[model samples]
Target: MALFGLFRRKPHERQGFELYGAAVRAARHPLFFARYGVADTLDGRFDLIGLQVALLIRRLHRDPDPRGAALAQAVFDAMFADMDFNLREMGVGDMSIAKRVKNMWEAFHGRARAYEAPLEARDEAALAAALARNVWRGAVAEDAPAPRALAALAMATDDALAGQGLDALLRGQVTFPAPRDMP
Candidate 1:
């Protein structure tokens, strides 16, 4: 069972931005990616997950319309890659931790709409909350990487949307500087 399995308590529904922010915060720990040297550089892999979360929020926040299932599959694949690299290369010296990560990956992959609407939102909120509760309490093993990869996957989808210029759709109104009259 996953560490949070013991609780068996469900969390309340939340806004997409709130969910994304929480996920980012949950995965923003240096000790996590720092372990395997995958994050040894100054690029700050520690915030990679958080960035991913932001990207996802930016996308979904911009576009309320549903995306094709293929997009979700691609995201799952990318997340699988990141999770593997993070655990195998940058994670602390712990096999169980790796197993847990693998379990999460499998579970996430097995899901159909990992990035779809209501289901996607549900997953993000649950993972973020669980990560926050665990990482804050140090419930996971030492040097054990946090489960930010999930959030990263969610964010990756947002990146695709942004690439398609869909960010403004969800971001709402923007104030651009007008040209000076003295031009």
Candidate 2:
């Protein structure tokens, strides 16, 4: 079996890399930072990426196909690996890097859970509150339109991902609706 490993053709991580790339592109869309008022800072970018990945994971979790779950985990591992590489590029010291990454990991989990229920319920108000707290770092007012607008986009994105086939998603293809079209 070990000898046959050298002949393996496919790069197993290709799909995960592609999917993570799509999520990053979607999270970086200008509308999110411009119209939605999500700051273009590092934290803002991280939160947006987390939200996008969480939605993708949610979609994958619903599929009866075990392949979807495996793909979802692969995407997740790819994200954290990128984070580790980014920290190194920024010159974060080795000791500090692990702590920072751990903090970010915890933050991502909390925010993902915060989004899950509201998105599942299609509860815009709840989702908006969560967005304001996480994306804006609680700097925005509860009644501000920014969070609400972002929440609308999130819901639409969720629905869009849900509609796409798992096979297509595995091919690194996913569609996100136009933010301008959302409420």
Candidate 3:
């Protein structure tokens, strides 16, 4: 147990936390809520962060290097830690935090699966529908611009990430597309 405790804190953990923080910062871009019509509500914010993280995870999963896998796991751990902190900050009872975090993990997994196929196919229409259903929770107006715009943003984001090197990502550096570049 003593040896296990010593190995629990890996060096990559700090970098992962920083990278996850970068993802969160990108997701909080004001343009998403102000211009793109992504709600400023908690759920909307979480969905945006989930989208960004999912993109990073997808990129990591594609890399053949073992370091990519390690970093991916670290980033995932950081995200869950952040979620736990957020729940605590929101005054969730200690006993309920575990259940809430589990639910959040399930939600994130479902969103990732829903996004993967359309993103891989680069199917704009399918991406738009998925974004509408998940991001907007199907409350968006039929003529709303948010769905298409957000889908475009996803594609642009993927492209931007593709341009980034795995080393840079492992160093806790990532860049998301500008809102103006979408659509």
Which candidate ranks first by TM-score, i.e. highest? 3
Give the alpha carbon lDDT tens digit for every residue of 85-164 in model 3: 99999999999999999999999999999999989999977888888988889998523688888888889888888778
TM-score of 3: 0.93
What C-alpha lDDT, on a 0 to 100 scale, does residue 133 get in candidate 2? 93
Kindly indicate the candidate among 1 and 2 with the higher lDDT: 2
Looking at candidate 3, what is the lDDT of residue 146? 82
User: Which residue pairs show backbone clashes in model 3?
Assistant: none
For each candidate in the order shown, give its overall lDDT on alpha carbons: 0.40, 0.86, 0.87
lDDT of 2 at 129: 93
Off by over 4 Å in 3: 1-8, 141-143, 181-183
Each candidate's TM vs. the true structure? 0.30, 0.90, 0.93
Top-scoring candidate (lDDT):
3
Residue runs of model 1 more than 4 Å from their true location after superposition: 1-68, 90-100, 106-132, 138-183
Per-residue lDDT tens digits of candidate 1, residues 74-119? 3334444455666667554675766766676554433322334423
Per-model RMSD to reference? 16.0, 2.6, 2.0
